[model samples]
Target: MLRSRVAAAGGCVAALGLAAALAAGAPASATDRTDPNDRYTAEEIHHFLEGFYGNHGPRPWEREHLVSDRLKERIAQTPGYDLLLCAQNEPRDIEVGEVTTAQSARVGWATITTHWSQSPRTAAFTAYVDLDGSRPLQLLDVDCAPGD
Candidate 1:
């Protein structure tokens, strides 16, 4: 009888162990996982823009990897001014505002404010970002704020 009881307890322990292992290996809930289609969240857009504007070394057009083909064409046509900041010269500091989703799920827009150290004036522009699933995030276009 004692041996049978010991065998039963061992069986129970083994079953419990198997259950725990299966539970541990189970996939996370749908909500916990990110959707591949919505990979580029608003926060990601803000970060990308912040990084792009923060680096003043390269011209917006020069960073072909970051700019879309359409934007590159626009830049080529419109010369002299920096299309990204919509300013003639690079700013001392760039403040990228909250990024919001546009009409399309794959597009986002943010207000980029450029501050110059030498002048009290500041320039603001609307930066359109393309969050293409097939490719990395790229700058779609830059529209200067009214009255420069």
Candidate 2:
């Protein structure tokens, strides 16, 4: 009877441990993008921007999906500089700052800080993101500011 009780206790402890592990490993609610109808959370927007700036070389076509058609047209019209990075040369590293929801329910803004290896200066930009319902989150525009 003692052996059976000990075995049962061990199983209970193992089950509790598994449950805790699963909970810890689970993705946050804000990061879940399964439903398109739901408004994009600040965390989601931050994650998207991080992935965008983290990539090397020229921006990929797939990454453009997150940008609106209007913004794409504007980018094409502009020449000599990268509107996204707001610089002629790509930075060695990028740091995406806090994302906050704007006055509009479907809009949010994030600060993107760029660090260059060749220069001591760092640039910052405010990225405007649109979270229209039933559609994937899209970047509307970026407010570029001079480097410090």
Residue-wise lDDT of candidate 2 within 1-148, one digit each (tens)? Answer: 9999999999999999879978889654533563345677778788877876773322766347767788788889779988877888878888889999753567888888888776787778888888654566677888887434
Off by over 4 Å in 2: 1-37, 55-58, 103-105, 146-148
C-alpha lDDT score of every prediction, in listed order: 0.75, 0.75
lDDT per residue as tens, model 1, 1-148: 9999999999999999879977889764433332456446687788889878774524545476788889888878878976766878878878888988753666888888778877888777888887654556788888886533
Off by more than 4 A, model 1 = 1-36, 55-62, 103-105
Cα-lDDT of candidate 2: 0.75
